[model samples]
Structures are given as structure tokens and as C-alpha cells.
Target chain A: MFWQVFLFRVALVAALVIPTPFFLTQAHADENLWGYVYGTDTLPAGANEIYLWTTSRNQKGKGNYRAWDTQLEFEHGFTDRFQASLYLNGRSHQISGGALAEDPDRRLHRGLEFDGFNVEFKYNVLSVYKDLFGLSLYIEPEYQRIDKISGERVNGFGLESKLILQKNFFDDQLALAYNLTLEPEWKKFQATGERERELELEHTVGVSYRFLPHWFAGVEGRYHAVYPEFKKRESDAYFLGPNIHYAAERWWFTFTFLPQVSGNPRIAGRNSNGRQLSENERYEYRFKIAFNF
Target chain B: MGLLSNFDQLTCALSLSSVRRIYQAGDLADDLVKCRLVVLRIKIGFPRQGVIMRTAQWIWLPAACLPVAAISIPAYAATYLTVEQAQQTIFPGEKLAPANIMLTNEQAREIERRSDANVRRKDIKLWKVANGGYFIVDEVVGKHEFITYAVGLNADGTVKQIEIMTYRESYGYEVRNADWRAQLAGKNAAAPLKLNKDIKNISGATLSCRHIADGVKRILATYEIALK
Candidate 1:
């Protein structure tokens, strides 16, 4: 009941904020790059945009394991060097087989549900056209509720930040971007009232080339590391992918497919009951479409 | 191996020939070289990818495939019009005397303050037609590129015609249409000349339309103070 009321309030806030007529303009070309590699380019001052995206992760193991997340984002550029965005996120999980098979109530249920809300701000420190490389700082704060397979709920509050750098060559035809991200999260279990903390560090490098007027092809490599208690290194993974982007005057779409090239052993340890704790996903795919008004 | 060498030599020769022509054009040599280099990199990069894919089997097949693709890749070309061509198109067969006007810092600032467009340069090219009219050339920034245009005015300081000489942006080419350019005709110094008011904007070409309209307003103001 509390979750329901919180979700209604978030939806109401989104409704009230979206209709404010502040500004409108066409989207930029570099804005269609991969999600992990934030572009150092900002829209012209007083420009507004809306972006919609879906991400699917396919885990390799057992029976039918996948996760899907969908998000809606509204962004506005208040000044040439400052921009802010709001996001509403939702997720779905497909869990079949494994230990959950023994429990009738937790056996096989796959459906989508509301997840959370996030607010982000980005400030450009240097412009690529004026400086050697573009540099920007970004921060996002998020609140989410996760529904587990055992009918338990976990609520989390998290903060993520990134330092983004980008450079363009050949009259903006070729672009290279790098991002270093850090996130700290705190979660509280509703059932047991237990709290946990986690820290994550991620680095991503991407390169894109505009082969045609509206088409761009690129590749990105990412390295992710996690610490459960902020002190001990728990796990790490590497992902590499190819991305393609297409943009018209007022709309754009981008798709990326990332396969985990390497990671810590999936079967890291076993519980006292001899059940193995496997690693995360094997591959992920993302699709994003955006419209400028 | 022989065929591969020949193909490389052929591309080099073709690139050099185009470079020679660019040099002959003279004014835009540096810009042309930069644009050509970008195109050449893409053309060369794609063929190498194909070669890497089929390296073990039939190496020559990939080299053979290069000519068809390389020949079709068009260079980034920007059209340039000499002053003679612009005058002939604006005021056909009539000789125009060069009356280049140099603006003082205060004059440039006044024009910039009054107009919606930003004046990038201090000197404005003005031509006095044989019939006491004026032909003016100015450049305005549209998005990231510069758009050069020619404007002709009658002796009474009213617009006669406007012609877009060079447009560098990939989109918004519709601003070059005769019907859109015709709307600026007969607009005098006193007119509002504002976008969406006196001039209607093209749906997809809003930036180009607004910048061009703002540019015309600035030029008209320049004519009143400097050329009149």
C-alpha cells in the first residue's frame, strides 16, 4: 500500500512537469550514442527533448532467465553549459527453474512492474569546439523499489556520478568519448528490516563515425567493478559492443548489443546448503528512441 | 599482388588530380583538402574491413571489390560562385562597380545590437550597379556552418532579389527554393522582417529560415546607414 501511494505521487509529479512549455528544438547528432558513453555535447540553450529506451539482459544458464528495463526521460538545457533531466524507470524479470522450482508460489512468474524515478544534472566544464577535448560532470540521484521472487520488497536510494570527456575530429565526423562513473547505493529490506550498502566503479570508452548524413556506427568497451561493503572487491566484468544510430531532423534512434567478454567466475561460492551463486548476465541489448519538440 | 598495387596507384592518382583542381579553385584550398581527407579516410577504412574479413581465402577478391565502391563515394563538394556570376544572376548584363564598405567597430556594434543576427565580420562587400542600385554579399552562420548569400537592392533601398550562393549544412537546403527567397523581395529597411511574422518559416528548415531572415534584416540596415 505504501509503494502504491509513492508510485502515484511520482506519476503525478511527472505529469505536472512534462507540460511546462519552456523550450523546443531539434536533437543533436551525437546525442544518439551508446547509453554508457555519455556524449560531451549539450543541446542549444532552451532546448527540450524526450527520450524513451528499453534494455534487456539475457543470462546464460538454467531455464529462461532474463531481465528487462524500460525508461522514459525528459531533458532540458537551461544554459549552453548546463542541462537537467528526469527519468521514470520500470523493470521486469523472468525467473524459471533453479531453487525457486521447489517453492510453488515462487516458481515461474514473469511480468513488468514500476521500479523507480531518477533526476540527473550535467554541467559542461569545457567545450570541444573551444578546448582540446570536451569535458563534463554529471550526477544522478535515484529511488527504486524491487519486488523479489520470494515476495519480499527491497527499497534502495542511490547516487551516481560521472566524469565525461569527448573529442571530435574530421569536422565532427569522427567522435571519441570516455566516461568514468561511480555509484553508491543503500538498500533496506522490508521483510527483515535489514540494510546493506554497495559501491560500484565503471569505465567506458567509445568511438563513433558518421558514415552517412543520418547514420552512425560505433563501438564501446566497458569495465565494471563492484564492492559490497565499500571495502572488499566482490566482482568485476567486462563488456564490449557495437552500436548503430539513425537520426532525422526531430527524432533519433540508437541500438547497442553488448556481450560480456570476461568476468569473475560465475560459480564464485556455494551456500551452506550447497547451492551455487552464479554471476550476473552474459549479454545485454539496448534500444533508445528520442523525439525533440 | 600486381592488381593490388595498381589499385593503390589508381586511388593515389585520383586523389592527386582532385587536389590539383582544388588548388586551382584557390580560395578554398585548405577547406577542400580537409573535406577530401575526411571522405578519403572513410573510403579507405571500409575496404580494409572487407579485406580483414576474407583475408585467408581469395585476398584478391576484396581488392577487386574496391573499385566499384570507391568510384561511387562522392567527395564533399561546396559550390562557389564568383562575383561576376552573382551579379549576372541578380542584375543580368549590367556592369557593377566595386564599392566595398568597411564598417567601424561602433557601426558594426549598432547593426548587431539592432538586428537579431550576429555580425561575424567587419567588412561588407557592396557593388554599385550601373543603374545606381547596389549588390551586397554577406555570410551568416546557420547551425554550425556559414551560409553565403547575395542581395540586390533598387535605388530606393528596397530589396530586388536574394540568392543563396553557398550552403554548407546537410539539412535545411529548402531555404534555397525560389518561393522562399521570393518572400524577402521588396522588403525595405523599415519593415519588421521578423521570422514567423512577415516571413513564414519552413517546417523542417526553421534554423536556416530564421537565420536567413535575420541576415536580410541586418543587410537592409547596413544599406540604410552605409550604402545610402
Candidate 2:
């Protein structure tokens, strides 16, 4: 009887608190300053926004390669520290001979294909405004039938979660953010009945300065490691670059040009200058635009 | 890796994160000690299953904090003061009576032309002092929020003091500094009231500074045309 009562109380509390953010009465913040890093800020309550992202991954240090990914995201703020989003994902890649067709290699994508979708939730425990430092927890669950790199039809499911931290200075003229992310995925091929489990750990940091009222400039760095089948570390990559952002009244756009600084490719000798190329691209340029309503 | 590990412990503390105890710049030194303690906690908690970094990071960590020693983050918000408090603070022993004024379109346009500031509203919120001075409440657009401030003028129509009643922008909180507001005191309609010229502009809060300066100028023009 005691255990049953405890479970009932827990379920009742969860039911009441889980739906509080969906009321959509007030909205707070709708601007993003970095391309790859996230800040621990949220909308007030009852606000809606749309975001469009275009990311270009180019150059593999060997053979001409290019990939463009697009995501149409709809975001809603339930409260000051809680928000949710839905995404429509699309991906296209072009590669001309870099030993991807070799044995034990993966399939490559050539044209535009619609990938699966992703649902994201974020909750802030602390904010930079009143707290010593800002901290937020973010989680996204993704399901994809097409491989992002190979574009082959496969059953892939991924769960990505991150801890975001932010700090501001100089009357919010200078802002810094950091994110630690872990993603675990499982994929199974329908044609060959092949199974794969992968784990990824990533750390990203961004420092931005509002040089002008409507303009912000920053630099971001990312270090990520991939573990195939959750065993040995397969590859590790480093990226660093500059980002620029412009915010209007209800719309804002941020762009970043990140180049792979160094990495361990561990691919069929397709590395460039000892940098990872086959598994990771030489550079990534991402542009994001958001509209608040 | 070490910094990320530090954040994990910090998250536990953030879970208790109702920041009801925050201080201004005067208490920044104590805050630095708190930050160092947090970093110390991170160092103490860095023994994981596989990661080993006890000596190598300790030797270089102090030098890494040199750049961070200069940073201080403060929150900006609305609701700095209220009208009754501002009235008492500006006009200590004297009583003030409501002397609100309404302006015609031509008069508003004329005030705008003379002061180079837009007259946002026709009806002005003001009060007349027993000593023949006045107090006015006005609002101006900031980058993202609206700023409401009160200006107290002298009997001769010059600015006596400027008080920021509420400032809700992401930047430009420095406009509330008494030293900066001192520049506006004793200035009449002959003053330029231009930001970065007669009035020093805050580095990040340019819009707030400019708008407040423009509002002051318009208020002076209003006194000359409507209240004088």
C-alpha cells in the first residue's frame, strides 16, 4: 500500500508539472548568437518562433566532396526556462571518388533525400541574468531512415543530450557559452541486415562580442570523438572558426565558417595533411535564420 | 575535459539555483573567491574511471585564469525605481502637484524639430514643484525593451537631475550611473543633448544612452514651448 501510494503521488505531480510550459501565454527570448554552441536562455511563456538552418560541409582533403543539410524547425516556448521544438530534416551530399566504394566502406549519397525528424526539449536550471552562471539541460531524440553521410536507407535512432553553460560580461556586450554533448545511436540495415551501434562525445565553446548594436562577432571551437559500437575510439576531430550574427526586431540570422583544424581520420588513407577527411569534412559553414512571433 | 567535468558538479549546485543572493560590483572580489572555490571543487572531483590528470593541469590552470580575472557579469532588468520614490528623492521637502500638459500635432512636430527627438505622446506626465521646478515621466525605445525615466528640471528650465525609473533592455544599464547623469544636470535648451557629444555614451548601451539624451532634450523643448 505504501509503494502504491508513493507511485500514485509521483504520477500525479508529473502530470501536473509536465504540461505547465505548454500554456503559451508569454514569450521571452528568441535570438541565438552562436552557430554550434547553445546558451542557457529561454523564452518567457507562450511564445512561438521558426528557425531555418542551412549547413554546408565541404572538402574531405581527398576527392571533391560537398554536403548540404537543411532543417526546418518550429520552436515554442512554454515558460521562461522550458521550451520544445520539432524539425524536418533534409540532407544531400556529392562525392567523386575518394575510396568510399572500397570494401568495408559505407555507401555514399549523391542527391537530395528527406531524412527523418527530431524532437528537442530544453530546460534551464539557472540563468545568467540573476545566477552566478547559466546552466541548461537539452535533449533531442532523432529517428532517421536515411544515413546522414551515406544517404542509404537504414533504420537509425539517436538520442542526443547536452549540458549548456553561459556567462556574460561588460553589460552583456561580451558573452561566452559552452556545451557538452553525448549522443548514442543504433542503426540496422534492411537489405544486408547489418547492425551498428555508435556513441559520440562532443565539447564546443563559443565567445561572442557585440561589436555593434545589431551585429555580433565571435569565434567557436569544437572537439568531438566518435566511438563505433561503443567500444574503441574510432576517430577524433577538432574545428575552430569565426561566426557573425545580425538581429532585427523579430528576425535574426547567424552564420559561422568552421574549418577542421586537426583530426585522426582513420579512413582508407584519405586524410589530408594528417587531418581527418573521410569520416569528417575539411570545413563546415552553417547559416541559421530565426523568426519570432 | 577538466572544465566539462567541473560543470557537472556545478550543475548539482545549479539545481538549487534560485539566485536570490547576488551582489553588485562592489562585492566582485568576494565573488572571485567563490568562483575559485567552484574551480577547486572541480579539481577535487576530477578522478574518473579512466581519465588521469592530477599534476599536468594543476601546473597550467592558474595561468589560464589570467584572462578571466577581468570579467564580471551583472544582470540588467526593469523596475529600478517608482514614481513616488523618484518624486521624494528629487524634491525632498517640497510638495509637487500634477501639471500634466497636452500638446497639439503642430506643437509636437515643432518640439521634435527643435530638439531632434520625436515626441512619442501628446499628453505628457508631469508635476510642478512649489519652487517652480517640474518633474516629468517619459518612455523611450531601447534595443529590445522600453525605458521609462523621470527628469527633474530647475526653476529656470534647466535639468536638475535624471532618474531612471525602469530600464528593461539587454544592454545600456550604465545610463543609470550617477556620474553620467551628472552630465545632464544644470543643462537647458541651449545644450546639444546629443549622445557621444555633450552626453557621454555607454559602450554597450548606446541606444539607451541616446534615447535618454534625446528624451531629455525633447523635455527641455517641451518646457520652453508648453510649460515655460
Candidate 3:
């Protein structure tokens, strides 16, 4: 029981610091600023808005982890049909273990990480007949900074881009959207205790559906290929998750789960004989609460 | 795999098909802590369960049933617009006495809609007495306006008072700004009001003075039918 709590805290901390700005931006896009008027199903022109969010996650295991995310988001409507936004996401994670870790004395570890907080501009390239359905293409350029994390620490700029396809049916009763992004990451890691630059690649695909007002559900999958500064080692990671959201009158909540779909160990250095070490992976059940003005 | 284990836990929380399937799932008693997390998500995710559409109908149903709700929501109820009754009660075309009447539901709705659209003078309202006296109700000044020395009938269809309310005119000088309202003293159904040159119209404030005189004239028409 104690171990599960520890794992929950650790997983939450990592998810919170991921700098996933698009999630926070999308939440405010359709909400109204004035209480009387209903917000639109499509982004309104010349509309500028702000949002703040906090997210946490936990894993069901011998250890538990908790994470926190805080972000300030700004979006501007260039035209009635086009809009752009910038989001700044920062987060920290805390991990504790009762028995989840092989090292029983590993009581706690805290680390802060930030993702690519990019300025993304979106244009409504085309609208279907009667503007019933539309397609939007957006490009985001970002700089990611990482302060603490073993083997993953880097201070480098990255470019993340997304193409979204959206459709509205049943007279706006339902909305289905698909989002795809290719996030390129580079970091300066230390080999032989000396700084070295390493390159990484990530691809993400997500689908969201709003079956009811103020409520939406989605699923996302990510493939991360992590290469070391030196050619001696190789590792890869995978995450797939279900995300659910509810929002009403200045309040929003979200929950998600990513159980770490794949983690294959790397072959150790030539000198070690048949000994293995299990690396840390991000496996979490997450929750988020947000308020907007 | 780690993912498979978490998936199993989620399925256990979401699937309620069989009691045995839930309890017999491995470590049900032990993994109750994990199960609690799943339940929290389900509970907070009420909006995703299509509750918004259901709640919208519920809240709008009661309000639309009140007055112009039919015009707003389109289904639950409609306004009672008896045009003939309104014609007789609000604007009776009787020669002897004009109908001084209260507003009908449709008229009230029109006033509200117009006021909202105008935004500048949203505080305007119209009031009616039981008997048949219609007064220009200006809540802005916290007072009522009627013809000078004019008798207002009560709700029971009897003459209530004979008072000179005001005679402020905005246009002409036939009737001075201060004395224009004094012309209607002691006027009743027995003495029809003549708000023309014979009666006296303010020179620059003619339009305003005429409004007061015409207002009294219209009220007399309402009184004729309401009293009968």
C-alpha cells in the first residue's frame, strides 16, 4: 500500500513537467470570456485568452510518485478563422519508495524538468461546405530546458510542429479531432563526466472526441528514440495513454494513464558478464486541475 | 508487462458486469488503493457522460415556461397573446373615455427586448391600475405622470384621484413648460380631453405636451371598455 503511494507521486511529477502546452491551450480555445455569451465550437477571430493548469500522476507499484505542473498560456485570434498561441509549462516531480525500488533506502528523489514551450501559430487553411468541417495546420518552434535528470539533462532549442484535422457533426453535438506532431529534442549529456551533445527524436499521435459540452476524451501514443552521446549504448521508450477531461464555469479537470508500453534494456558494456540493471521509466496515472480567467 | 497490469486494474474499475469478475480479479482486496484512483476519475468525469446536454434541457425548461421562454427555447410553453382582449383592454377605441390599461404579456416582452437592445434606457417600464387608469410609469424619477387635474380610475373601475401631475414640454410654448400639465384638471369621461390648439400646446415643447395630452386621451379609451 505504501509503495503504491510512492510510485504515484513519482509518476505524477514527471507528467506534470512535460511542458505539454497544446493540452492547456485547447481547453481554453472554445470557452467564452463573458458569462452571457456561449463560446464557439470554432476559434473566434481577434480573441485573446489565458489559462493556468496543475497536473499530477501516480503509478500502481511498490513506489509512489507525485508531480506538479504550472503553466501560463496566451492565445490570440488573428482573424475570425485563424489563431496563434504560446504556452509556458514548468513542472517538478517527487518520488518515494517503500519496496518498489531495489534500494530500500531510496526514500525520495525530487527533480524539475521543462518541455518545449513553443510559440505555435495556427491558420484555418480550408473549411468544408458551409464551414461545417475544417482543417487547420499549425507550426510550433520551441526551446526546451532541463535542469535535473540523469542521462536526460539538456539545454537546447527544439522545433515541434502539429497538423490537426477537425470535424463537427450532429449540429455541433459532437466533435472529433486528430492531432499529430513530430518533436525533435537535443540535449547536452556528460560522458566520462564531460559535457556532450546528444540528439533524440519523438513522434506523437493523439485523437480527441467531445461527445458532450464541457467534456472531452482522448488517447495519445508516443514513440521516443533516445541515443547516447557515445555509440556504446542505445535505448528506446514508448508511452500510450487514455485522457479524459471535464470543464465548466472557470474550472477544468483531467485524468490520464500511461502504463509504459515498452522498455527494453540495453546491452551493458563489454566487461560485465550476464548482469542486468533495470532503468527508470515514466509509467503513471495522472490528474490535473485548472482555473482560467 | 507493466502496461498490461495497469490496464487490468483500469478494466476492473470500469467493468461492472459481474460481481465475481470484480472480486475474483487478482489481489482485489490488496489493490483496493489503486481501484480508488480509477473510481475518482469516473466520478469527476461526469460531464463526459453526456450530462451537459441533459442539464441544459432541465435548466432551460423551467425558465422558458415563465414568459418568453417559448420564444427562447422553442418547445416547453408559449405566451398567452389574446389579441382581441389586448385590443379592448389596452387600447379600446371608445370615444367617450380612452382605455387606461396595463401592459399585456406580449407588450411586456417587447419592452424587455427593446430595452435590452437599446441598452441606454433599460430602466423604462409601464404600469397599470386595476380599474382602467394608465399612467406613464417612469421609475427613473420615482414618480408617476398623468394629465394635470386628471382623475385616475382605480383597479375596481372607479375614479380614484384628480391630481395635476406635471406638464414639462420639450418643444412648443402654447402651454408654458410649468403650466402645460394644469390643463387637464377635473377632466373625466364626462369631459373629453381636447389636446389641440383649443386646449393649449407649448410652442417649442409641443411634441412633449402633445404626448401627455395624447397619453390621457388613449387612457380614456381604455377606461371606456374596462369600465363597461
lDDT of 1 by residue, A4-61 (tens): 5345434533432343223223333236577568887666566677766667666544
In the range B17-91, model 1's lDDT, one tens digit per residue, is: 455465667665567546455433223312222232111112222223233323432333355566678889999
Taking all chains together, each candidate's TM-score versus the true structure is: 0.55, 0.56, 0.39
Candidates ranked by TM-score: 2, 1, 3
Give the distance in Å from residue B129's predicted Cα in candidate 3 to where it truly belongs: 32
Give the per-residue lDDT digits (tens) of candidate 3, residues A46-153.
445554443433432345544444344566766645667777655454445642233444344433334436686777664421244556676667665432222133
Candidate achieving higher TM-score, 1 or 2: 2
- Tell me what fraction of the real C-alpha contacts between chains A and B each candidate also makes: 0.00, 0.00, 0.00
Off by over 4 Å in 3: A1-42, A55-69, A95-108, A111-117, A127-133, A147-153, A189-213, A218-238, A249-252, A263-282, A285-293, B1-228
Q: What tens-digit string does per-residue lDDT give for candidate 2 at B9-119? A: 322233112221332333544464564444232233223311222111111222222222213112335587899999888888889999888999989998988997778
**Candidate number achieving the greatest lDDT relative to the actual structure:** 2
Clashing pairs in 1: none
Residue A109, model 2: lDDT of 40
In terms of TM-score, how similar is model 3 to the real structure? 0.39
